[model samples]
Target chain A: MADIQLERVRKMFGKVLAVADVSLHIKEGEFMVLLGPSGCGKTTLLRCLAGLERVDGGQVIIGGDDVTDHPPGKRGIGMVFQSYAVFPHMTVFDNIAFGLQMQRVSSAEIQRRVGEGAELLQIQQLLARYPAQLSGGQRQRVAVARAIVMRPRVLLMDEPLSNLDALLRLQMRGELKRLHHEVRSTTVYVTHDQVEALSLGDRIAVMKDGTIVQLDIPDRVYDLPATRFVGSFIGSPPMNFLEGTIRSSNGARALETAGVRLEFHGVPARGRDAVLIGIRPEHIAVERVAVAGGIPAGAIPAAVVVVEPIGPQKLLTVQVGPSTLKVTTPVDFAVDQGQRVWLRFDPSRIRLMDPQTGDAIAS
Target chain B: MTVAEQRLEQTLPPVRRQAVDWLPYVLLLPTVVFLAVFFVYPMLQAFVLSFRSPEGAITLRYFQAMLKDTYFAGALRNSFLLTAIIIPLQVVLALVIALLINTRFQGHPWFLFICAIPLGISDLGAGLIWSSFFTERGYLNLILQNLGLINEPITFLSFERPAWLYGAIVATEVWRATAIVMVILVAGLQLIPKDYFETADVFGASSWRKLRYVTLPLLRPALQTALIIRTILAFQLFATVIVMAGRIVPVLAGEAYFQYGLLRNVNIASAYAVLIMTLSMTITIFYLWLLRTKEEELGRG
Candidate 1:
C-alpha cells in the first residue's frame, strides 16, 4: 500500500555497526526479501523499516513521509517474528484482534477484520485455541493472521518459515506466496535461506557483512551475480573459485591454472597477472574424454573424490591438482571415486574476478 | 539339566548380590527415621492435641472457645487482612521493580545485590531495625522535627491510635518481605524470551499494553508462587508486630505465645497453637487450589 525507501541507513549498537550505509527502495505491493547469512544485518534492516529499530544515520521514508523516528505503532507496519510470538495468554481470536483493539476500533469492525483475516489465512477453526495448543504450522498461520488483521501499509516477516518442518515449510511458503498475491501489500521479508528468498521474493536483496552485495530479481541475482560473495552464497552446491593467472596462448586470452587452461575468445583484454575464475557446478560438464571444439575453452582432467546420489542428479566432488570442485551430473552416470574424468567449462559462464579486490572483471 | 538339578543349582546363596539389593534402603534409613521423629511425630501430636480438652475428654471445646472469643476473632481478622493487602501489593510491586532491574541498566548488579540484602537478614533483626525508627523518640521523628515537618514527636506505637499504629507495623512487615518476592519475580522475568517483547512491538503494542497482555500473563506462575509464599509468611507476622506494636496488636502467633508462657494455661495455649496450625493449613490449601486451577488452564492450552 506504501512505498518504503531507506536512504543511506546505518545502525550502530555502541561500537559495532549492525547495518552499515545501506540504501534500498521497495515499491508498493512488491514482495521484497532481505536474504543473507546470520549477522549480515538483514534483520536489522527489516527492523529499521518496521520502525522497531532506530536508524543512526539515514532516513526511512514511507508513503512519501519521513518516519525514521516514529514508533512501530504509528508507522502502520505489521510483522511476523521467527519464533511465532503469538501472545501466549490470548486465544487466536484475541491475538489477531490486538492491533485493531490498540487502535480503538469498534467491536463490530474489530470482529469483521479478525474474521476476514482468519478466513484469508484459512485458520477460522483455530480461533479459540491458544498459541501453545496449536502445532508449529498452525501457530505460524495464526501469527500471519495476527499481522494481516491490522491491514497495515507494509508487512514484515523475519524468517517465518524457519521454525516449521521441511514439508510444512514448503507448504507455508506456497501459502505465503498466495497470501501476498491476494493482499498485494508492500512486504519486507528477511531470511538466511537463499532458496526461500528466490522462491518468495519479487525482488531479492542479498546482503553480506552489513552491506547489500546485490539486489535484483531472483533469477538475475542467481545467474548474473555482481560479486563473488553473492555468486558463492546464492547457489546450493555453491560456485567454485579457481585461483589462476591470465595469459595469452596462440593470440587468444586464456586463464592458466595448475592442471587446466581456459581460453576466452570474446573476453576483452584485461591487463592483469592474477585473476580468479568462477563457474557454477551445473555449468561444468563431466565427460569420459576431452572432446574437440567444446567451446574451444577451459577443460581439466580431474580425479573424482566423492559421488553423492541425489535421485535425479549426482553431485561429484572432483579434485584437480590441489583444488576441489563440485559438478552436478546425471544420477545414471557411471562415475566412481578415484576415476579420472575430463571436465568441460563453458567459457561464457566462467566469471573472471580480480584476485586482490574480489571484484568481477568485466569481459 | 533336569528341573531338580537346576533348582539345586539356583538354591546356592550369593552374598554380594544380596548386599547390593539391600544397599539403597540402608542408605535411605537415616533420612526416613529423622523425618519420622522430627516432622511426622510433631504434626500428629498437634492434630491429636486439637481434639483434646482440659479434662482429657474427647471434646470440641478448643474449637468452640477460639470461635467464641472476640480476641481470637480479632487476631484471625488481622491475619487475613494483612495477607489480603500484602500479598497482591508485594507481588505487583516486585514484578514492576523486577522489570525495571531487568533492563540493560548500568548499576543493575549493585541494585540486585541491594535487593537481596534483606533476604539474608533474620526476620527478628529486620523487626528490631524497623522498631528503632518507629519508636517515640526514634530517628524518623527526629528527622521530621529537624526538617520542621512536625513540632513534636508522634507516638507511632501508641495503642490509642489503633488504625494508624497497626498500619505502621504492617508497612514494616511489607518492607521486610518484599525482597523475596522481587528475587523470585526477577528470575521469572528473565526466563521470558526477548523475542516475545519484540514481536509485541511489531504488532504495534504500546508499553502498557505489552505488560498487560504479554508480560502479566507469562508472569502468572511466578506471581502465584510469590503470593502464596507471602500469604503464608503474613500469618507468622509475630516478631515485627510485637516489636512495633508490642501488646497492642496481638496476632494469632503472639497470642499463642502469651497464652502459653505468661498465662501458664497449657490447655488454652495448646488450643491456640492448634487453631494457628489449622488457619495456616487452610490458607495454604486455598492458595494451592487457586494455583492448581491456573495450572490446569495452562495444561489445557
Candidate 2:
C-alpha cells in the first residue's frame, strides 16, 4: 500500500473548471472518502488520482514517486466503478484473473490467485457464471474481487455501492471495510451519501464547488464543522441555520432573530454583526410542555408544525418564531401538530457562522 | 394459464383479461400479412418458374442446362470470390472506422458524417463514382501521369487482366458497404458501457487487449447482424459489378439478368435467383452460428 498525495491538482473540461486546486494527502492504508453532491467535482478529483483524467496542473505522488505523467495502467492502481463494470463477456473467474492475464502471469498462478480471491469473496461456486447471471450484490463482489486480485498499491472506488439496494449497500459497505482491513490498501472512495462517508471513511473530505470545505474524522466533521456549508451538508435532517444579528451587551452576547433571542455562552464573536447559528436536529430535545422554572438553558419556545413518526424515532418540525427547526426525539416522546413545545438547544452544539461569507466565526 | 384465468375471473372482470389475451395476436397480424404477401408468395412463384419448360411440363432440364452453361462456373467462382474477399475486407475496414469514431476526437461529427456519406449513395452510383478514378482516361491516370508515376494510362478494368478488374470491383464494394458495417458497429460500441474500458485501463491493458477482451465480444450481436444484411446484399451484386466491370465479370446476379432480359430464358434466370437466395441463406446461417451469443453472455440473462 502507498500513500497518495495530490498537490494542488486542477482539471478543466473545455470552458468548465471541474476540479480547482484540490490538494489532499491520504495516509497509507487509510480509507479516504470524498463526499459531495452531484457536480461537486468529488468524482473528478478521484479520477485525477486514477489517471483516468489528466490534471491541468500539479503533481500526483504515489509512494513518494511522482506519477503525474503516468498512464492509468502504468500507475499500478485498481478501481471499482460505480456501475460495477464487470466484463460481461467473461466468467467471474476470468474477470478476476484479467489483470494477471494482462501482466502475462503464468496459468497456474492465475488459477491459484483467482481461486483464492473467489474463496475470500465466498464466490467460488460462481466462478463459471457470467456477470449477467449474478445479482447486484454478487456483481459488486466480483468487481471487488477483480480489483483486489491485482493487489495494486491503491484502490479507487467511485460510488461503487450506489447501485445496490439499501440492504445490499449496507452489506457491501461492511464487505468493503472488511476487505480493506484484510488487505490494507490505501483506498479513495467517492460518494454523495453522508452516512456511507461517516460509517466507512477513516477521514471524510466534505467537498463543495470543487473545493474541500472540511477534511476531518467523521465525528469531528459532524460535531465541529469548519463552515456553514459543512454544517448544513453533513448531517441527516441537516443542521438548521437561523439568521440573526449578534447583539453584545455588557460582556454578554445574544443572537437576536425575528421573535427569539438566543443567549449564547462560551462563544467568542469576531467582528460579525450578522450571524447564522447552526444546530443539529438530533441535538435538540423537544419538551412536552414549557415548564415555569425547569426550562433548560438556551430554550426556545416553539409551536409544533408537523410530527412525523419515522420508524423507531420521531422527527419534530417545530417553528421557533419565524424559523423552522427540526428536532429528533424518541418514539415514546409524544408531541402533536399545533401543540406548544419548548426546544432545548445544546449550547455546546451551536456553531456560529458568518451570514455574508458563509465562513464559520471562530473565537 | 387456464387455471390462472379461472382464478383471475374470481377477482377481475373477464373483458379486460380477454382484451389483454387478444392484444398479442392483433399486434402480430400486420407482420404475418406483410411476410406472406411479400415473401412466401414470391418464393413459391420462383420455385414454380425454375422447374417449368416451354411446353408447360415440370422438368429439371433448365437446371441441368443452366449448370452446364459456359458462363456458369466462371460466374459462380467470381461471385463467391468477391464475397469471400469483400466481406472480410469490409469487416476489418468497418471495425477500424468504428473504433476511430469511438475515439470521439475533435471534429468527430464531421468525420462520422463523411464516413457515412457512402451509405447515402446506391451501389450502382458508388460503382460509377469509383470508375471515374479507375478508368484509363480518368482522374487516377491523369494524377499518376502528372506525378510521373507512370508513362501511360493503365487498363484497370480490362477483361485481359482479370485480377485488376477484380481489384476494381472489390475496392468499389468495400467503399460502398464498409460504412453500413461501421454504422452498425458504432451503434454496438455505444451500447457498451464506457466503464468497462476504464476498468481495462486500470488493469494495464493496452489498446489491443481492450479491443479483444472488451469490445469484440460485446459487439458480436451487431457484427452478426451487419454480416447477415451485407452478405445477403452482396449475393445480389449485380448493379455495381455491371456498372464497373460489366461482362468482364460474370457474376451470379448478372448471369441471372443476362438469362432473363437478354437470353429470354426465364427458367434459367429463376434457377440462378434460387441459387442466390440459397447461398445468401447459407452464409447468413453460418454467420449467425459463428457469432452466436448465449443468453447469459449478453449481460441481461
Candidate 3:
C-alpha cells in the first residue's frame, strides 16, 4: 500500500479545463473519497491519478516516487471502473487471473490468486461464468476481484457501486468497507453520491467546479462544512439556506428574512450584513404542547404545512412565513398538517455564510 | 333501410380495435409481395431450371456432366484456392488498418475517406486498373525492364501460367473488398469501452497479450459477420476474375455465364448456378453454426 500525492494537478481538454490546479495528499492505507455533483471533475481527477489521463502540469508522487510520466501498468495501481468493464469474453476465473497472467505468473500461482480473490469476493461459484451471465451486482464483484487480484499499491474505484440496485448498493457498501478494513490498501474512491462519501470515506473531499472545497472526516464535514456549497451538498434532505440580513436588535444580533426574524446568539462579526443561514432538518425539533421552557433558547414559531410519516420519524414541512423549512420529529408526536408548532433551532448547529461569496462567515 | 344499417353497424367490430389489429399487416403487405416476386420466384425458377434437361426430359445429365468436366473442376478448385488465400489475408490487413484508423489521430476522416474509395469502385473497374500494371507492356514490366531485372516483357496474365493469372485476380479482389471488412471491424473496435483496455494496462498486460486476450476475443461477432459476407461474395467472384484471367481461369459464376451465353446450353448453366447457390448456402450455414457454437460457449463461460 502506498500514499499518493497530487501537486498542483490540472487537466485540460482542448480549451475546457476539466480539473484545475488541484493539490491533495492522500496518506498511506487511507480510504479517501472524492465526492461532488456531476461534471465536478471528481472522476477526471481519479482518472488522472490512475494514469488513464495525463495531467497538463503537475507531479503525481506515489510512495515517494514521482510517477507523472509513467503509464498505468507501471504505476502499481488497480482500478475498478463504473461500468464494471469486466471482459465479456473471459470467465470470472480468467478475469480475476488476468493481471497475474499478464505478469507471467505460473499457472498454479494464477489459480491460487484467482481462487483467493473469488473467495474474498464470495463469488467462488461464479468462476466459470462470463460477465454477461452475471447480474449487475455479481459483475461488479468480479470487477473488484479483478482489481484486487493484482494486489497493487493502491486501489482506485470509480463509482463501482453505481450500477447496482438499491439493496445491492447498500450491501456492497458494507462489503466495500469490510474489504478496505481487511486489505488496508490505500484506496481513492470517486463518487457523486454524498451518502456514499459520508458513510464510506475515511476522508471525504467535497468538490465543485474542478476544485476541492472541503476535505475532512465524514462527521467533521457534515457537522462543520467549510463552505456553503459543502454544507448544502453533504447532507440528506440537504441543509436549508434562507436569505436574510443580519441586524443588531437590543444588544443581540439577529437575522431578518422576508417573513421572520431569528435571533442569532453567536452571530459571526463578519456576517453583519446579508448572509445565508443554513440549518439541517434534523436539528429542528417539533413538540405538541408548548410546555414552559419547552422550546430551545433560540426558537421560532411556525405552522406545519405538511407532515410526512417516514416509518420511525415524522418529516414536517413547516412554513415560518413565505419560506418553508423541513423539521424531523419523532413519529409519536402526532403532529398533523396545518398544525401550529414551535420550532426549536439549535444555535450551535446554525451555519452562517456570506451571501455573495458562499464562504463560511468566520465566528 | 335505417334498421338494416343499424344492424350492420352492430355486426362490425370497433373501428379502433380493427385499425390496431390490421394496420401492421397492411404496412407489411407491400414488402412481402416485393420479396415473393423478386427473390423467392427467381430462386424457385433457378432451382427448377437446374433439374431440366436439354431435350426437355427430367434427367441428371447436366449434374453428371459438371462432375466429369475438367473445366468445371478447375473452376471449382481455383475459386476455393482464391477464397482460402484472399479472405484471411484481407481480414488481417483490414483489422490492422482499422486499428490504425481508430486511433485519435489527425486527418482520421481523410484516412477513412481514402480507405472507402476502393469500396465505392466496382470490381470490374478495380480489375481493369490492376490489369494495366500486369500487362506485358504495362507499368510493372516496364519498371522491371528499366531495372534490368528481366531481358524481355513477361506475360503475367496469358495462358502460359494460369496460377499467376488467378493470383493476380485474387489480389485485385482483395484490394477491392478489404475496405468493407475494415469498416466493419473499425466499428466493432469502437464498441469496446476504453476502460477495458485501461484495465488491461493497469494489469501490466503486454501489447501482444492485450491483442490476444482483449481485442481478438471482443472482435468475434464482427469477424464472423465479415467472414460470412466475404465468403458469399467470393463464391460469386465473376467480373474481376473474368477481367484479369478471361477464359484461362473461369470461376463458377463466369463459367455459368459462358455456358449460357457462348455454348447456348441453358441446362448446364442453370446447373452450375444451382451448384454455386447451394455451395454458398452450405458455407453460410456452416459459418452460422460455428458462430452459434462460439456464442453458446461464451454464454456458458
- Top TM-score model: 2
lDDT of 2 by residue, B164-225 (tens): 88888999999998999999999999998889888888999989998998889988888999
TM-score of each: 0.91, 0.93, 0.91
Task: Tell me how each candidate scores on DockQ against the true complex.
Answer: 0.50, 0.64, 0.52
Give the Å shift of residue A230 in candidate 1. 1.7
- What is the per-residue lDDT of model 2 for residues A1-363, given as tens digits with 9 covering 90 to 100? 899989999999997988889999999999999999999999999999999999999999999999999999988798999998998778999999999899888999999999988987889999999988999999999998888888889999999999999999999888888888888899999999999999999999999988999999999999888888888788888999887777777977777665456656745644767778788998787776545556555567789899999997999888876688888999988778998877767777888888888888785
Backbone clash total for model 1 is 0
Model 3 agreement with the true structure over A253-331: per-residue lDDT tens digits: 7766654566556676543578888889998776655555555444567888988889988888888765788879887
Off by over 4 Å in 1: A249-251, A290-298, B1-39, B54-57, B68-70, B149-151, B288-301
Task: List pairs with backbone clashes in candidate 1.
Answer: none
Q: Write the per-residue lDDT of candidate 3 for residues B170-199, one digit (tens) a residue.
A: 789888999999999998999888888888
- Indicate the residue-level lDDT of A362 in model 3: 71
By lDDT rank, best first, the candidates go: 2, 3, 1
For candidate 1, what is the TM-score? 0.91
Candidate 3, residue B236: how far the Cα is off, in Å: 0.9
Each candidate's fnat? 0.55, 0.80, 0.67
Give the poorly placed runs of model 3, Cα more than 4 Å off.
Answer: A248-265, A269-271, A287-297, B1-31, B54-58, B141-154, B161-163, B293-301
Evaluated against the true structure, the overall lDDT of model 3 is: 0.86
User: What's the lDDT of the predicted structure labeled candidate 2?
Assistant: 0.88
